[model samples]
Target: MMIGLHSAPFLAMVAFVVATLVRGMAIRRATGDRPWAFASAKGVQRIAGSSFALCVAALLVAAALAPANGTNLAVLAAIVSLAGAAIVIVAQMQMGRAWRVGVREGDAPLFVSHGLFRFSRNPIFVGMMLVGLSAAIVSDTWWSWSALVLFVLSCIVQVRIEEAHLEASFGDAYRAFCRQVPRWLGLARSA
Candidate 1:
């Protein structure tokens, strides 16, 4: 069993890149006419894009160098990727017009408190992180984890900036919503 670049890791990386690019371009088309709140948001999006590129590059390198082993890690990685994909789909369905990457002011879609949003404020980011982590796990490379960590941190910063912009635009409504929802991981209901 020759475990190398042609194995599961490389395929997973390619799938992730294709999915991300397709989704991102769709989002750009969806929100192209909106009035964004901050110009820096575009820069942040570009940084995120670059970080994803780095993640794919690292995954490819790891795949190329991975030792031949029939460990269960590959199976776990596939499960995680599938789970992440499901989460992304659910979040996207719930978001509808609110499924944007940047901050917009003009009578934007109302805040959604149902579906995935009821659990985590940023389900899409969570899903993306899960996918990245799964890729790292599959590659069995420390550098893959580093890329995932950097991508997650970048997302956190972007989320904070987005939250501020939303609060400014949506006023108390946004604040109250934030108070109720967890920033990252979804928590159980308090009932």
Candidate 2:
């Protein structure tokens, strides 16, 4: 088990899970007085996206351990995943308590477009995408490819839902931010 931990796909999955757990704890602690500050972004879209992501993670593990997988790429995958994990950490830190798992409703009025949020509307999700890509590279299997495909498709839907929510919730402010910042990264067109 200890040796298996070094496998790239497993490590990537673990890193993603651990980072999320830490973020959850941070959210709980930060929201001690104002619990409504956080919420489940849960919705039909989110549920479907989350299901695909979970499936990918599970399938990647099995693929990574299979005999066809090689060690040479594992280290590279591990490095990429670590970098992605680092991004997740930074994004979560920036959000602090502002991070919610899904679209928030009622009361919370803050729109964060500073820090890493300025670079990417969904930094955490971007980082997770990196993690998924790393898993695919490490496993180099059809299963892992399926996982990556599912994750990418999920992100497309998730982003649409989230952007719609942000637009509705923050109105002009969010639209301005949208104009200012590219959805993933790079410079946004000026409004």
Candidate 3:
């Protein structure tokens, strides 16, 4: 049975997945290098990345299985999810060739601190969290909420790893940028 076919949550999740895949494909086509690194990760990175990917899948499953609700709240959540998906694509584009799924050994992309990065050091992750939150809201299911929580936790671990890599690679420049931009999003400090 095609349950929850018309649910906004399911639609939003689909949209986010489509946007991410399309953008990733475009980036890969533009550059010869593969942008994906989940499969190549090891140790903690491997665990976190795999966990995040699984959470995304769990959210998709939960959304599809949840009961359909066409309330205004669902529509709002869909809109928010769409915005989040857009943010992911836009931030990725802003990073341009610098965008990557995970850290690569000796693969030093440019230190991006403009566009969406100026507002949030981790805009891509922020957008992902938005998608997870919206999926939970639209689905209104225990499974969806649990998936969202796991998604957030996984992101936290992954972000810390990426941040450390950036700091080591970019040194003072990365630290200065971190000081100017909040981890997520907020008013920039004047200093």
| C-alpha lDDT values of all predictions | 0.66, 0.69, 0.80
* Backbone N/Cα/C clashes per model: 0, 2, 0
Candidate 2 structure quality by residue, lDDT tens digits, 91-157: 8778766666655556344667778887888888888778787777766678777768877777777
The numbered model that scores best in TM-score is 3
Model 1 worst lDDT window (10 residues):
33-42
Candidate 3 per-residue lDDT over residues 1-191, each given as its tens digit:
55442355566668767766776788789887677776688999999989998999998887676656667767777777777777887887898878778776666677788888888888988888887787787778787899899999999999898889888899998898889889988866776
Q: Cα deviation in Å at residue 29, candidate 1?
A: 6.3
Q: In model 1, state the lDDT of residue 115.
A: 87
Candidate number of the best lDDT: 3
lDDT of 1: 0.66
Q: How big is the RMSD of model 3?
A: 2.4
